[model samples]
Target: MAAFLGMRGTGDWTDSDMRPKNWRQGVLWQYPNGDAPLTAMLSMMSEKKVDDAQYYWWTQGIPAQGGTVATLNDTTALADDFTTGAVAGQTIYAKVALAVAKHFRPGHQAMLRDASDYGVDTRGLVTAVVHNGASSYVAVKLIEDENTGTGTNLTDCDNILVTGSMNAEGAAMPSAIAYD
Candidate 1:
């Protein structure tokens, strides 16, 4: 038998101290926290190579507010929409990260949407995460095609990104889950 120590910052995978002796030695997966606004926020910085809000649009995260737990440790159903408060007219969805305990079904497409329920044009990859203080599972809608292209639908998403760390930090893992 082998020992697999679980740590944080494995880059969307279970942090394990031991190496995988075989194909299934350890379980590593991506956990969603929320649709991070970093992309949109950075786009505003004139110093950086930024793009339009549409390129940073992502529909995958919990609402910044109003996440109440009905029971102790019960899986909470959560959702979030973009706002102009922080990033001008552009808005980004919040979501939790995927986890090792679960596997994101491959080849899934999420229809991206906005507050108006209209499909908008976007570019680049969306970084999702698991929000703070939640169970392993999150709400996700699988996509039939990966052809998100330059303008994927916002209404649909594969998974709602949630907080990454299992700890109380409630943010992405500061360091690699398991560094060499």
Candidate 2:
């Protein structure tokens, strides 16, 4: 009774083998092509690194232009804010607005915005199938406590769906993603 094998190939959770070979968008989470049930996109459960984008900035991911949301992250965004580009580091699909799905318990620290998967954003640990481009989309490595000394600051048109940080196997599973 323990042989699920879902993502089809399991290679980076499928979806055409994940991606990120040369696209730009540091954070991403799309899962839902077939079965669904994989959540989590950034680490969280007790480490308390829950940040939100309300006043921080950085952007640049224009292969076809679908990675907008820039104010300073770098790449000079402003083409009506990208819409769906492709290669520079791979993986860029934004449009979020979440408010549920919380089971964090691996490292404690989660978030999602403008990562419109529809289901209200943020599911469980979508597991990590990722990377970034030369600071890919300009620095997006905020781990914890920033500006207010507690962690979380991704302001300026929030955009998330980066499900890439899952390794749960002992209790708290439902992944993560709990915003409001």
Could you give candidate 1's per-residue lDDT for residues 74-156 as a string of tens digits?
A: 12344334222221223233343333213222121222333232334222122233434334322332222222343544434
True-vs-predicted CA distance for residue 125, candidate 1, Å: 6.7
Global lDDT scores for all candidate models = 0.29, 0.30
* lDDT computed for candidate 2: 0.30
Candidate 2: stretches off by over 4 Å: 1-143, 147-153, 175-180
Worst 10 residues of 2 by lDDT: 95-104
TM-score of each: 0.20, 0.18
TM-score of 1: 0.20
Model 2, C-alpha of 130: deviation from truth (Å): 26
Query: What's model 2's lDDT at 27?
Result: 28
How does residue 149 of candidate 2 score in lDDT? 20
lDDT of 2 by residue, 5-117 (tens): 34332234335655532112122233333233332222111234237534333554423212343322222231234332112332222222112112222333233333333
